[model samples]
Target: MRPISLLLILIGCLWSGGCQQTRLSFTQVETPKVPSFTAPTNAPTLAKKEFTPLAPPEVISLSDELSLHLLPGTPSKLVGIHLLAVSPDAPYENLDILHTALTQLSVKLANQRDLPCIEGLTIHPSIHGLRLSLKCPASALAQAVDILAQSWSSDAYGELELSRLKRQLALDKHIRAFNGSEIEEVWADKILGSAHPYNKALNNRELQQSLDKPQLLALLAQTKAQSQWHLLLEGVPQVDDSLREQLTASLSQLGAQQRQEERFVDTFSPYGKQLFVIDAPGTVQTQVRIGYHLPMGLADQEDSAFACEALSRWLGRSFSGRLYFDLREQRGLTYGIYGRCFNNPMARILKYYGATQQQHTGAFIRGILDHLKLAAEAPPSEAELAALKTSQFSQIALRQDDPGHRIEDYSQAIARQAGSDAMAARLKRWQTLTPEELQALAQAHFGQEPVIVIRGDLARIRPDLEEKLPEWQLKVTSVD
Candidate 1:
């Protein structure tokens, strides 16, 4: 049997339903054991060094954008790459170009480093340009940093790189002044209100017309003056002090102005039923996403996250999950069904999503709601609870398999103001939660009240079930 991660990747590809024919292809991949390579025997043992703590650079707090994460662990032969960019809306517009440039640069840099060991570096750019984060391993960090530093420092394409940097920096100001009226007219038209944060699709012509080198520079200066930039490093305890100093010195060269403090708003919308439809005229299949806002942070309610996860697993995760078995396995009405609950400091949102024949949209929705209602009313059977717990435990164990994951998990928890051990501790807490507690949380949060967002061929789905859905008042919104 394939490892769970590989299995999940395969399932995800199938679930998207982009492929016309389902073909099973099997390949045997070896799973390497931990502690693969040993440290050099002749390497000098350096004394553990500590530096005077410098205050974190004046930068926007991770919480203000999403959660700022920090993960620290024993030093290993891995190098991490993190990109922090500022853009008016989505960073992708610039990053797509940056990625192409970086790919070429990576190859050129690898040859220079004389290290055949370089491979598999991950780069992740965010929806909005708040930050583009990445991670390799500690062993690779020095070489990767050298390549990046040289690239940024080079004058060959310095003018062009600076131009790109300027445009990316403009995003901060645009987001700060994102008044509903202007945003709706410009960017919000392409996104459901609920998925606004994840919507990086920018009005390209409008953005390009509005942006220029002078404007970009002015915004970068403004961001720097406001002291709204900083970088973080975790893992590889040996390099923490040296890396921090090097990063601070490197960034200071940018000559960003220091600011006092930056303020952020905590906003929330009450729970209720809402619908957003995006009509794709010639599309054969519909893509639907259902999400809800949940309380933010781990400590919000006592063990609320664990309870929420348990509920999600029982109703959202497995074929055994309520929606999957009812809508896909038995009814055969949809290709896939699942749920997600993202916990953040500001709010947590739960989502149930699937794709089905446009004709079966109504039946799919009803079946999901019915399963949700049943799960809410009654606690899962002992067998169900055990299965969920086992699954959760297994997933937690799998996360530790990758050094990068460990760092990310730790970093995220710290950024969220949750302690470093929070993830592992939460797993332990979940084990002790009773089925009654899970049911009560479900009753309180699920089925009883939820603000729903549906984006699909509503014309086909709505006519059949508009009257069947409960008496709650409904508001309809169109996607242009």
Candidate 2:
């Protein structure tokens, strides 16, 4: 009851002449005890289970120059045929043109055949070279393969209109000029030189003069003649014998060619110049990329591979990385940030990039550099290391269940020339990885000063950068 109400009742009792009999009472109760939690005196440590690696894909040589790698998938109605062609001679631009041509031809063939092939007939440029994928219903697998083979042999795009293509190029360039990440282009230019074939810029004038029906045909002919091809079939049990024979005949049409040895290009710049800026006059935020060219790929350094993976995860693995915690959570400098190992056929780049407000760009860069320094100084904690290893194992298990992801992973392995069992070997190595080993690797690799690329309004960011990182040399350039 409220105090006011109690007083009113007391006054009423006093007025009624019954105040002497009115008395207050009190009661006390004992408090209950919380149950004690006794720590186990002999808690058992988690026993490491021995990992059983997935069986490597079956490889069968279709011809002296061509091979088919098969990985059985769940008994499903769909199947995937991935054709990989690798050649240093094939420029990405030409490959892109061929991809467009082949895509159009595939659609035409599908329409003509009246095959309900609506899902997955695609081609794209990969780090290895050109990748063409045909995922169609298993019932139509042979027909789909025949369609693709026929399309490759056909001269469907021989009458392609050059003027129309040039107009499309102009529109594409216009769209990319405003929509694309300018920082990426600048980064490529800096890392792989402006004149490098990989860094070749596509301009309307150059494309107009060079790109046409004849050029496309010549490139296609060259690819068919010189490029080494690897075909992978992943789906269902037992690809029919007739289908195999058809594929073999189609591949045999192209003359036997030796696998071209990957030419090593000296891609990395010497570590001296540290900072570069590309000016974007009207931009409100800055794009920052900082990284170094690794000496070699993980596949080449088997002993240090797991350690490198651990280091990468420690530096940046989405939200779990230290870079995210320090730069975004602690300082509120940027909305997102990441560090990763970019594996190319010729170059292995360890890059960190993100975007931030113009004013915070300098601090953001500082935070990244500081984290790299910290990585060199100390290893990840036991908890962090444990989490990273768990994620690795979990990814392996999960990817194996999905046939699409499995095929992609297998193809990537083939592209890197990292054998079919690379992940299994990595698994074996990861079980024995230690914090001290990771620290050593980090000190060796992460201690170096990395090249930095910043793209934003230079006039706005320059002053803040000057104040924060004045010791670093700043090279400014106009956005291309």
Candidate 3:
């Protein structure tokens, strides 16, 4: 028979189970031996060097109208400059929009003039006024200064800019409507009444109506004419005679501007134990903020500075925080949680914030409240306090080399109308603060019924909140 015929016959026999007499054998392989497990050895330590503390900042009066705060360090090639324009006039509703427009105009003007040094310039609107921050090569400092000085005075306000700003604002409003990102405004209203300059809660219509070209131009002119400008130089300890002359010439225009009359009211009516639910329809995730209006501001209660810092750090230090441990690690209620104290010069508010799924909203808020109660009753252990102090010390040490952070500290001091050395004094005091003082501060401020602000699909989250937190009076509101 042919080989094919033989194979087919064998296959048919195997299928029919008729040829199961023969067995084929091959060499067997041994399994590889497993190695025994061993614990890791201790890591080698590096040699410690003697610590050299950074020199205290030197505040110099460059002219009768201008002052400079210089911090000592090995200056970097790229210097950070933080400028603040403080306006005493009534807060402009569209100052933030104007900031954006002016920044864009400045960049356009820079590109046209072939000045690439202004590449990373940024402007931020604070409660006081506009803050301009930028870093450039040391050689280009004079040009950068001129660029910033001229940006505020440029005729950048026109019909085209107004249209662009309106579009941007409209798009932002729509996004915020869906995401419920206006909780800070609610907090401001709750803590710093609606009449406060910081609490200008404008609806979409009001915002659009306030964008007239003439009004914006006038606001810009008023800002330039009345604001007091402060220039903070980082990485520049002492300017040479030539650089000093250039800086003075560039800043004299700003310094000569007339100061506006002040009109500010610090009074606030407290919202005692209220739950505000902002209805953001179709949002699957919810944003929660629980805030306490503290007894005094940082300016008034400088003694509590370290205590407030320690209490805030203990309550919500990310993975190690009490709130995070209870809400996220233990219960898987949310992704992240944090607590922060806003020590503005006039207003002091401690706030805890987090985001959670719709289903976990009630549990998350309840967990935060329960932990706050626990924190109020029991203070941090010695080990916990030690760890916080060590962390804070390390942060301070690291900030010694960072001009940006140094300038920020200086800016805060200036904003408080405290001298440049205010932060240094606070840090000096913090080094000797005892755990008993921190505990006392925590006890006095914690567990007060906080004003709760939640933004979510109210229909879905409201029922659980009512069931879990029957004591909190719930009120639903829409974004204005």
Model 1 alpha-carbon drift over 4 Å, by segment: 1-122, 127-143, 146-157, 161-205, 218-267, 296-302, 470-476
Candidate 3 lDDT: 0.67
Task: Choose 1 or 2, whichever is better by lDDT.
Answer: 2
In Å, residue 40's CA in model 1 sits off its true spot by 51
The 10-residue segment with the lowest total lDDT in model 2: 26-35
Candidate 1 per-residue lDDT over residues 317-410, each given as its tens digit: 7565667766676667777888776554434456677776665655666666666677677777677676667666666666665655654544
| Candidate 2 global lDDT | 0.67
- Candidate 3 lDDT by residue in tens digits, 1-480: 699999999899989887863321211211111112232488665455433456656776778777666655335567777667765344445565666577667667656655675667777676555778778777777888776776665354442367777777777677865455688667667766667665661343574656776766766776666566777777775788888788778877674667546656567655666789888877778899986777653465776555566667777767667677667776777899998877765466777899988877777787777777766665566666655666566667677657666666556656657654565676676566666766677777774677888888887777778776888888876545
State in Å the error of residue 150, model 2: 2.8
At residue 433, candidate 3 shows an lDDT of: 62
- The TM-score between candidate 1 and the true structure equals 0.62
Which stretch of 10 consecutive residues in model 3 shows the poorest summed lDDT? Answer: 26-35
The superposed Cα distance between candidate 2 and the true structure at residue 361, in angstroms, equals 0.8
TM-score of each: 0.62, 0.82, 0.81
Which candidate has the highest TM-score of all? 2
